[model samples]
Target: SNIDFNPVEDEDSSRILFEIKCHFNLVSEKNNDEYKLENRKLRFVYLSKLNDEVTDDKKLLDEIEKFYDNQGYPEDMNTFIEYMPQDSYTNCKILILRFHEFLNLEGEQLRLI
Candidate 1:
């Protein structure tokens, strides 16, 4: 999603200049079988500022790593979070979530929307 900030409002009021993309996976199970299916990946780029007195990059990265590690995925699964500086006037931060592996589930637990 492409977002634009408006100067008319005192509060954070930004406009999305472009389309937004989102991705999620689906799982299904048959009588005695289980399956994992992959879905299209999404990329979201946004501009936001870090909280006050939080300028330590290592601490921020470590926190994100710890959070992903505690998510309890299989050993072979991989997850990563990266932060980089941008040229925007306001303090901006970009977050990327990538799901590379699928989890196994029972058929009854699968809900189709």
Candidate 2:
């Protein structure tokens, strides 16, 4: 009797799975508008990561192609990926603003003398 349980043993694959899970959690916590926008933004990151690998998984390959079709990017995905760093910076600023709000620090004076 053989069981068909395929656990991800490869370190890189496991790391990718963990990252995707984390990303999914972050996206799911947002409101509908935020979720849609973040989901599309993060899809670019995944596309860039997967583009570097030589994979034989037809399903994944097909999904990648479908993404290009749906997104209508140029032939080179890197051209679009170049914008991620700035996008990440903007997201960090938003997070910092939220953090300050959570701490009730908005419009407050910090005296460090």
Candidate 3:
């Protein structure tokens, strides 16, 4: 999992550019069938407008890093995003899910969505 919480704000306003590129699996836990456990690259992009109180983006990054470091990063999204010959897949089938579509979902709903 990689995080790019760089502060990129114009002179007009403060906007922190937070971007994280990580792996997410589309396979749901609710599926009791054979698990497809090999999607290593699900790229999710998220953009948001931060509040004005967020002046220091780097500090925010550090704080976030520390928090994640202590509590561990989010792991429910890890999935295979690409097909490589080494993975032993007979076909080239890649599944990708947009983060926006699953943003409002929670728990089992999020996984199923």
Candidate 4:
């Protein structure tokens, strides 16, 4: 039987996975009502697409799935977009995610690989 457990092997991929996991943990731990007025708790976390040759949305989604599955998703993972100002007439679209403290089998904030 062929199992598609695509483990994060490449250094770049590994770094990305670690960064994302840390981001989730940070956001979850700092999730408070006062700071959540407009979901400002996750403003500094994101995944960049500007450097990747694989520009397809579907492929990116698959990569995210593989990373999450291999590394394990956080309890209350919430994903969103963070718009960063780059220059005039331009803004960087950063992918941000926050892990919640609910619906977790392991009852953890994050599991980084």
Runs of candidate 1 with Cα error greater than 4 angstroms are 1-53, 73-113
TM-score of 1: 0.22
**Candidate 1 residue-wise lDDT, 1-113, digit = tens:** 54343222212211111111112221232121211221111111111121122345555444434433443332322323433232433221333222111212111233341
* Per-residue lDDT of model 3, residues 1-113, tens digit only: 64445433332111111111112332443241222222111112122221122345544334333322332344432222121123344222221222222333332342564
| lDDT values, one for every candidate | 0.26, 0.41, 0.28, 0.34
Question: How does each model score on TM-score?
Answer: 0.22, 0.26, 0.22, 0.28
Question: Which wins on TM-score, candidate 2 or candidate 3?
Answer: 2
Give each prediction's root-mean-square deviation over alpha carbons. Answer: 15.5, 15.9, 15.9, 14.6
Clashing pairs in 3: 24-77, 24-79, 25-78, 25-79, 39-79, 39-80, 40-80, 41-81
**Residues forming the 10-long window of minimal summed lDDT in candidate 4:** 96-105
By lDDT, the candidates rank as 2, 4, 3, 1
TM-score: which candidate is best?
4
Which 10 residues in a row give candidate 1 its minimum summed lDDT? 39-48
lDDT of 3: 0.28
- Report backbone clashes per prediction: 0, 0, 8, 1
List where candidate 4 sits over 4 angstroms from the true fold.
1-7, 10-51, 76-113
60-107: candidate 2 lDDT, tens digit per residue: 444454554554543433222323333344443343343234223311
lDDT of candidate 4 over 8-54, digit per residue (tens): 44555556544655655545422544333222212212222211333
Two-way lDDT contest, 2 vs 3, winner: 2
Of 1 and 4, the candidate ahead on lDDT is: 4
